[model samples]
Target: MPLNIDWRQILLHLFNFCILAIALYFLLYKPVKNFMAKRSARYEEEAAESAKLKAEAEELKKQYSDKLTNADAEIEAKRSEALHELHDYREKLVSEAEQEAGEIVEKAKKDASRERKKIIDGAGKEIADMVGAAAEKVVLGSTADAYDAFLNAAEKSIEKEENEIK
Candidate 1:
């Protein structure tokens, strides 16, 4: 009954406080700590997956770069081969054209020689005919002595021309 002392009531309050602390530890603290731990583990897993994906992407980029470099080298080699082929073809064509031109020039010279021979033959035949006709006119209605002389001169001239032709 004193104003400053009550041992029984203090013991009762202490027992109630202990019971509340036990209930709170099981109901709130344990579950909250478990949730926080699970969240942290999930974050770590996600970070590892992101790093793995980044590494794979870098490997793919290197492969593509190597392929591009090889392709460029192949293209350059093909271009060089084409240029060489073109040069060889041009040389062959030029040689063929030169040979054809030489053949044409030779043929032209042969044709000109043949034409000259033909013209000379035609002129010789015409001259012979003119000489024969003139002789005939000179001997027309002549005396026997004059006709004999004309015939002898004509024979000698024709023999001389034949010897010269030979």
Candidate 2:
């Protein structure tokens, strides 16, 4: 046999290698590649769904935050309104109390004045009666003209005092 390569043998080996490569591609490589592609697609779809759910969660969180802020503002407003109402109520009560106190004082003053006038009139009548009795006894021995003169002076003095009081 010659050491030189045979063309026919070389051609046969090249043809057999082509057939084996084709067979491996169709039997193993194609199916593995297709499965890998399907797995990648599934992963990408899951990632997209996760992102969408995350965005939805963020929106919900923002909505709840806004609601909480609004509730706080409303509570503050209501508290302020209540405080204003309380202040007004306190002022009204104080005003009414002062007015009632003033009225009571005025009534007391009027009552006191009436009582004083009654006491003064009673004292004056008693004094006049006592003086008349004394004058009658003292003037019993006097002449009728002298007695009448004394009585007239006493009546004039009483009238003058009464006029001053009035």
Candidate 3:
């Protein structure tokens, strides 16, 4: 009252401000704080779950990569093995062909040799018959000498035929 100050009005206004503060704390501040806490907890849980999923994905990726590499190596090994087998088979076929060729050549040589011997024997017999006929016509008086001469001539003819054929 001394300086126109109304102490009663001041006290009443202060009391009203206290009531408003308390009401706001309970109605707005507490609810907002609890909502924020729940939201933060949910966000943290989602982050943990996301991290776990990411880690599992990374593990699966690494495993798949390893398997892919191993598969490539396995495929290469199989291809190499197949190629080696093919090469071996080729060699075996070549060897068999060579052996067959050698056998064919040997058979041909044997056939030719037998044919040559047959021809030589036939020629020798023909020459002997011809010489015997000539001797009989030329020397009717000296039979022994004629026979010896025919034998010598036939032997010489056979030797000459063999040498020429060779």
Q: Provide the overall lDDT of each model, using Cα atoms, as 2-decimal numbers.
A: 0.81, 0.84, 0.88
Off by over 4 Å in 2: 130-166
lDDT of 3: 0.88
TM-score of each: 0.58, 0.73, 0.75
Q: After superposition, which runs of candidate 3 have C-alpha atoms over 4 Å from their true positions?
A: 2-4, 140-166
Model 3 lDDT per residue over 48-112, tens place: 99999999999999999999999999999999999999999999999999999999999999988
lDDT of 2 by residue, 1-166 (tens): 4898898999999999999999999999999999999999999999999999999999999999999999999999999999999999999999999999999999999987887787578657755665675577566655565566656766765686577557
- Give the Cα error of residue 84 in candidate 1, in Å: 2.5
Cα error, candidate 3, residue 160 (Å): 18
lDDT of 1: 0.81
Model 2 scores worst on lDDT over the 10 consecutive residues at 141-150
Q: What CA root-mean-square deviation does each model show from the true structure? A: 8.9, 7.3, 5.5
- In candidate 1, what are the lDDT values of residues 11-119, reduced to their tens digit? 9989999999999999999999999999999999999999999999999999999999999999999999999999999999999999999999999989877876865
The best-first sequence of candidates by TM-score reads 3, 2, 1
Residue 55 of model 3, lDDT score:
100
